[model samples]
Target: MGNLKLFIGVLVAIFIIIFLLLIFLVYKNSNMKKNISFLYTKNIELFKANNELTKDKADLNRQLNGNDDVFSELRLALELDSVVNSLNESGDGRKIGMDKKLEGKFVKSIPNGVPLNFKGITDNYGIRIHPISKVEKFHQGIDLRASVGTPLYATANGVVEYSGMTSSGYGYLVIISHNFGFETRYAHMQNKQVVRAGEFIKKGDLIGYSGNTGYSTGPHLHYEVRFLSRTLDPINFMKFNNIFYDERKVPWQALVKAIDDF
Candidate 1:
């Protein structure tokens, strides 16, 4: 035989080079299993974009800590409405001095310095119109204006109960009688330094100057206040009375002579 057909054609070319090296190792293991399933679907979309960037950085740190607690409760309700409109340091701004701590607690019915002198009041009781019989009536009291003599005082600890001409026409009165039932008066005055009827007076003393005399209207300083017999409303009791015996100089109009009242 021709050398046994050339060793069976060199074992059929070594079994066709082992079937083309097993079809190039099964096409490089199907392109390395499609590059390991596209690197596990891009690492599950980069772990859902790093878990949605850690839930958008914890929703932007809870909206910046709820806007820093609503800007610290709107800066503590504008510093407690600037200490309740600084009641009466005679407004015009600056001097609202309030220690704060309010949600309602702001009581001070009366008694806290009490000196209430004058700062212009020129009439303000009620149903006005009568500047001098211009018509409508009922203006019980509160004229204040002050100029002639001006002293007046007393406002609190009292007893006088009658001082001069005021038989009702109050032309130079005084009254007083305080201690709960609280009577006050003061009227026109001007005949000068006079404070008699039972006398006890203490809250600032003086108790007499300021003239124009009852029922009229011009010089001014009527100021009345009754309370059990009723009358009340000396300009809403000096716009919420704390009177200020003297808090280092209050009087911007001190709260409200209706300095517009509250």
Candidate 2:
């Protein structure tokens, strides 16, 4: 009876050991499965990150290529180019200083030399009291005082539109139409030579001679510039034409100061 009881106790110990071993094996397998799942998720994320980086690099390469169309690379680039071109086309006041007009623009030119008085300016343009009449009135042009027989010059290249003694105040009026809406007139001339109706005259060419033929206080040349039959300030045009002066003639210190201040 004692031996049978001892054998039963040994059998119970073996069963307990077997149960513990099975539980340990099951827990180890569960941990391995969880680790595999985590690794799969990380691999997917890395693949996505690599794909995005490759796309970004390709875009950079396209932009760097010189052969690529300027409009390509990005939609925003096309918009920026359009805006810059528009600003340059507007011209505004800068175009006058730069002398760079927009494409297809027909730019006119300023006339050369002083008009009217041969030695100096006797009268200016705009409204002023008439020296002879002594009444407040608008002066249409400038008066240059000079002696008779002084050679008159064509202000610009143009064809003679009219040349004759005027019924009004002009003694010997010569009109040269430069087309492009620009016309120049020389009045109070002593003689009309080298110019006639329908004759083309070059710039600086002899057109007439100054005289006191017209109603005037003294001998003078009346020069007028008209655009489409409307008078303009001849002084302004002369100043604009003065842009091509010699910088060497200007004081170097003044030029340097202007640049520095600007």
Candidate 3:
């Protein structure tokens, strides 16, 4: 009877040990499940944030490509003396009033180079706030930052249409008339311009020097390019081959034909 009691006690102890081991395994499994759930939730949140960043990047790129004028600041005036109404009441676009003699002289009279050696660009072409007026307006040209007396060059082979002081805010300016209805203007120039009105000039010819003249906060060259009196971004002409002429409503085909025929 004593031996039977000892066996029964040993069996009870074994059962108790098994029960405690099972409880420990169950508790460990519950903690592991909680950890896995937390990791999964954190991963989902990170994925959502990454997606939002990608979308923002795409939107910013679209804005840059679609509207270059969206970032324009500081106004530059367009006051060319010879500019006529490019578009008539009928909206007939791009009337090329080329001087036959001038066209014959220069077949390559297209503005395709930087007007001067500029350190950098302070303002780009488009709508922007006028520094003096503090009001929004259309800026017709780009402002190239350069020190006073920096030598300016003719961007194309053309005849000087105007070269003198102007009360219209571009203190001393020079406008060159080229073939294919294209024209280039250099503004805020020093009082002494080497070229005069009706003088023939070739591409890269020294025209004048930059200055702090007329509506300017500092010494800079305000450069402009136009086709039939319509303002075009000077940047496009600077990289002449890369100009998106179609989007800017210029007659690329006519220009090509004129050049070819000439």
> What are the Cα lDDT values of the candidates?
0.62, 0.66, 0.77
Model 3 C-alpha lDDT versus the unseen true structure: 0.77
Model 3, 1-262: lDDT tens per residue?
Answer: 9999999999999999999999999999999899999999999999999999999888777665544343211010011101122222234654445433333333357787788889999989999999888999999999999999999988888999999999999989999999778888899999996999999998888999999888898999999999899998888778654353323456444454556457
| Candidate 3: clashing pairs of residues | none
TM-score of every model?
A: 0.23, 0.50, 0.59
Compose the digit string of candidate 1's lDDT tens values, residues 57-132.
Answer: 8876765555565444444444434554453354565443432222122322221222346677777877888787
**Residues 1-262 of candidate 2: C-alpha lDDT, one tens digit per residue:** 8999899988998999999998988998898899899899999999998899899778767765543543242333333223322333434534332223311121123354554337877889888998777999988888888998888887767899989888678788999897456788888887555578999877777888898877777888888877678876666544433222211122323322333333
What would you estimate as the lDDT of candidate 1? 0.62
List candidate 2 stretches off by more than 4 Å.
1-110, 115-117, 242-262
Candidate 1 to truth, TM? 0.23
Model 1 spans with C-alpha error above 4 angstroms:
1-124, 129-134, 137-186, 190-203, 209-221, 224-233, 239-262
- Ranking, lDDT, top scorer first: 3, 2, 1
Between which residue pairs do clashes occur in model 1?
Answer: 87-255, 88-254, 88-255, 89-252, 90-252, 90-253, 113-245, 114-245, 258-261
RMSD of each: 22.5, 22.9, 12.5
Q: With candidate 3 superimposed using the best TM-score fit, by how many Å does residue 88's alpha carbon deviate from the native?
A: 39
